[model samples]
Structures are given as C-alpha cells and as structure tokens.
Target: MTSTHKNGLSPASVETIAGLSAGLISTIIVHPLDIIKTRLQVDTSSHPLLNSSRAVLRDILRNEGPTRFAALYRGLTPNLLGNSAGWALYFLWYREAQDVIRNLRGYNLGTQLTSVDYLAASSASGILSAVLTNPIWVVKTRMLSTSATQTGAYPGMIFGLRAIYKTEGIRGFFHGLTPTLFGVSHGALYFVAYERLKEWRKVSKKDQTLTNLDTIVASSLSKTFAGTLTYPHQLVRARLQTYDPGATKRVKGPGLVPLIQQIWRNEGVIGFYKGLFPNLLRVVPSTCVTFLVYENTRWALPRMFGNADDDPSNRTTVARKGERAL
Candidate 1:
C-alpha cells in the first residue's frame, strides 16, 4: 500500500507537485532562450538576416515594435502548460515505475537501482509524457514561428488551439510526435548518467544526501551529454511542427521521411545541428535549475506539509545512519 502523508498526498503526488514547481521555475527562467532556440531551429532559409542570435533578436525587436521585449515570450502560455504537465506526469510515472521495479527486485529504500533500471523507467516515462504533452508543444511552436505583427498570427494559446483544430483536425496537434518519441532516448541517457553520477558521489563522499552543488553538476553534465546526441531530433521536430504544407507551395508531403529528405537535400549534416548552440545554452542552465528545484521541492514538501516518515524515499540519512550504528 502506498503511504499517505499528513497532508493526504501520496509519494507519487508529491513527486508530481515537485515536478510542476520545477518546470514552472525553470521555464520562467529560460523561456527567452527557448524562444531564441526555437526560432533558430525553424529557420530554414539562408537569409543573411537570420544568420546569428544577434540577428534574430534584432529582427524580433524591429518587427515587434513597442512590445519588442514582450514578444520574446510569445509562446510562454503553451510552453508553461506543456512543460509543467510533462514534468509532473514524468515524475509521477517515473516514481511509480521505480517503486514497482524496486518491489519486484525485493530491494529496500537504501539499495540503489541499477543504471539499466533507471534507463528503462526514464524512457517509458519520458515517451509517455512526451506523447501526452505534444499537442501543447505544437501550439507553442506555431506561436513561436509566427510574429505578432503577422496578419494571421494566433493571438493566444486558445486561439491557436481553436485554429489548428478547426483547420487541420486532430492530426494537427500531433505534429513532430515521431521525432519526439525518438527523442525519448535523451531522457533515458540523462537519467541513467545522472543516477550513476549521484551514486558515484554518494560512494565517494560516504554520504547519502546530495548537496545542491552536487545536483547542479550531475544535472548539467547529464543534460549536456544527452542533449548533444539527441539535438538533431529537436531540430527535425521543430521543422516538422512549424511546416504548414497546405499554406506553403514549397513541399507537397507532410510526413517525417519527406521532411528529413528536404532538410538533407537543403542543408546536409549541418542542418541537423541548427540552433544547437542556443539549445545548449538554454538547456544547461534550465536543467540545472529544474533539478535543483525538483530535488529541493521534493525534500521540503513532506517536511512542511506532510509527514516526512511517510516517504520511504525521502527518509533522512541521519536516521539510516543511526539505525546502522545501533
């Protein structure tokens, strides 16, 4: 049976809450970078104007006029919703999967799960979360790609949702889903490496508790490693999401294979790594902050509003040490 905290939240619920908080905090901190990254990814043309980050920022400012700064946050609403819900669902599912695996293996709270176990759990949770939240990402992509000064631009997330549904049906919301599923390997790699790093630190330091600096290092290294390998998929997904075959005479096919072919034909291997610099810039700090918030929130939630003892995973190392000393 799942233990209930004093506040009537289960361990999984606490994880979800922690995840939501982390997502919101991180998104707010790095959303402008996200905008820059997305804009860079979706720019297929070789125009001199869109060549660099400075150029993109200048273009946005010039186009957006008085509210130029605010224009940087064009897709914030859907991004916030998608990221918050995705992280919440991911943590809830990941914790549940970990619990099930631990129980099946007859492992206690003190026992660490293997890297393979972390990979499996993280991949499953990440794919499910990615699929569930893809529609929100599609809307956000559309919002980001279109300028506020554009005549047919979506005024808000609701309008974007309505427009896509009314015009393109349900399939519209699922654009880039194939690449997203493939991108699940990013999360798998990140969590596996992160868990291994944390385990190594615990063993080296002889301490079960990780400091914030520890978390930041683990999260940043893992994110950079995973992100570099999987970044091409993100570029492909952004391209696919913003590509409107009906509106543009440039392409006849709307499928992933066709899109890949087009990008290959146009830009070769370098095309896949477009926006990679800004993406790394955006994701490193974003991952660090997210993990920091997530770890701290998870640590604090039960203590403040629930019974700390209710969470086996959150049991104090001091208590474990005391028990061992006895």
Candidate 2:
C-alpha cells in the first residue's frame, strides 16, 4: 500500500508531533513569565494584595531581583517534560480519533479536517492526558506556587513530588483535574480556531501556496486570539490545581460550582481572573512559539524522512513510541 494509504502516521502523528514540539519550545522560551503568572495566582497573603498585578510584579522584583527570574522557571524540568508528554499524547489520541471520525463521516483528507472534528479529537486527547499526567502537573504546580517555608524546605521538583505523594497520596496529584480539563478545552478551541483561520487566510488571500512560515504565523495568531478570549478559565484552572487542600482554611475542591463559590467568597469574582494579565502576556508568546515550532518541525520532518508514503508504518511507529516517552 502507498504511504498515505497505509496505517502509518494516520494524520494523528502530524498533529501530535507538531503540538509536542510547539509546547516544548514555547515552554522553554516563556517559562519565566509562567512563574510570574503562577506566583500571582497562588499568593494567599494579605501582604501581596492580590488586586494589584503591578504590585505583585514589583514585589517579585524588589524581593527576588534578577534572582526572581530563576523563579520564572521554578518547575521547568517537570513542566517541560509534562507539557511535552501531555501535548504529544493529546495530539496522538486526537489524531487517531479524528481519523476514525473522518472515516465514518466520509470527509476527504485533502480538504482539511473540520473545526468540530478538531474539537472532538482534542477534547478526548485533553481528558486522557489530564488523567495520565495529573501527578506530574500537580507536582509542578506546587513547586511553582509555594514558598520555601510553605513547602518545608523542599527545594526542587523531585523532593516536591516525593513529599506530595507521601503526604497526600495519589489523589493529591489530581488536585485540579476538573478545572484543568475545563481549561484545556481552550487547547481544543485553539487548534480548531488555528486550523480554520489558516485555511480562511489562505483562501481569502488567494494564496494557495502557503509556507511553514504562513502556518506558524496563522497558528500563533489564532491561538493568541482564542487564548485571550478564554483566559479566565485558565486562571481558574491554575488556581484550582494549585489550591492547598491542607491549608488552614482550604479553598473548595473540584467541580465548577464549589470552585466558583470558594473563589468568590475568599477573593471575590475578580479573583477568578487574578493573574489574567500576566497569563495573557505569557500565553500569547508561549502559544506563538509553540505553533511555530510545531509547524516548522512538522514541515521539516517529512522532508527529512522523504515522502509520506514510503515506510509510513515505520514512521508512525517511531512517532508513537517517541510520543509515549515524551
């Protein structure tokens, strides 16, 4: 059978690798911003006054200085690892499912997948990845959110994970699964919007010959647009994920109602979007780099490997194994 017609890749690999590469590159580039965003969201003390993003920024600078930049990457090791794995798994499953959906619906591959298709595939992938990688993310979030005192002198990701697992058990690792899923729906929305926007840009501009650059720019813009619109959900997700269940007065647990109520009671409705500015600042560039890396990597991979039809199964197998390891 031809490479395209064989079981190799099956379109899922394309999306998976692209997403994974993008996430890795983006994380590395914007990790510092992420640290700032996390600190702002998780700060519970009256000293910082959560209302002021500028005050939060000033505090980090005054107290931490350039050293604070290090805080930007507090959980870099696990976050990059987890993010890469998460996106890869998300894409693989998303693509595989999309393939099935396409087959059932009689959609032509050359015409591009639809938004609904992208949404369904990405949603399924997001949920699966959230469940599988919750532990890593939980550890990462804790490391990102807490101070040395709060963590009892634990300094790094390894110690952090050990402490949480030992103290809180497996359930602790899934602290914010619900909000995380809610937030990750943005990822689905992101890809779908990205794909559709790219297509529209290409068609409306009458540019049938699009390049990797075009794809990257289009994908970035779409993600930035969608990310900004849906950013409050992300703040809520982060807050929920990093909530300290063992604190003196704990916030609410999982589920939308309890989470909203707790945040409103403790920090007010505006609290739901506390770190939104910093988050937007971080997410836009992060997303831009992510799609750029993903699209460019995807473009380069096929050229490096030659035609898609040649040894498609081998390519798919290798890609799948690599994704699982991510």
For model 1, residues 66-121, the per-residue Cα lDDT tens digits are: 59667888889999999899999998898888878888999976677888889889
lDDT of 2 by residue, 120-202 (tens): 88788778988898888777776666554342534677886777777767766777777777777787888787767766756
Provide the lowest-lDDT 10-residue window in model 2. Answer: 312-321
Instruction: Report residue 28 deviation for candidate 2 (angstroms).
Output: 1.2
Give all candidates' CA lDDT scores.
Answer: 0.80, 0.65
Model 1 scores a TM of 0.90
Model 1 ranges with Cα > 4 A deviation:
46-51, 243-253, 312-326
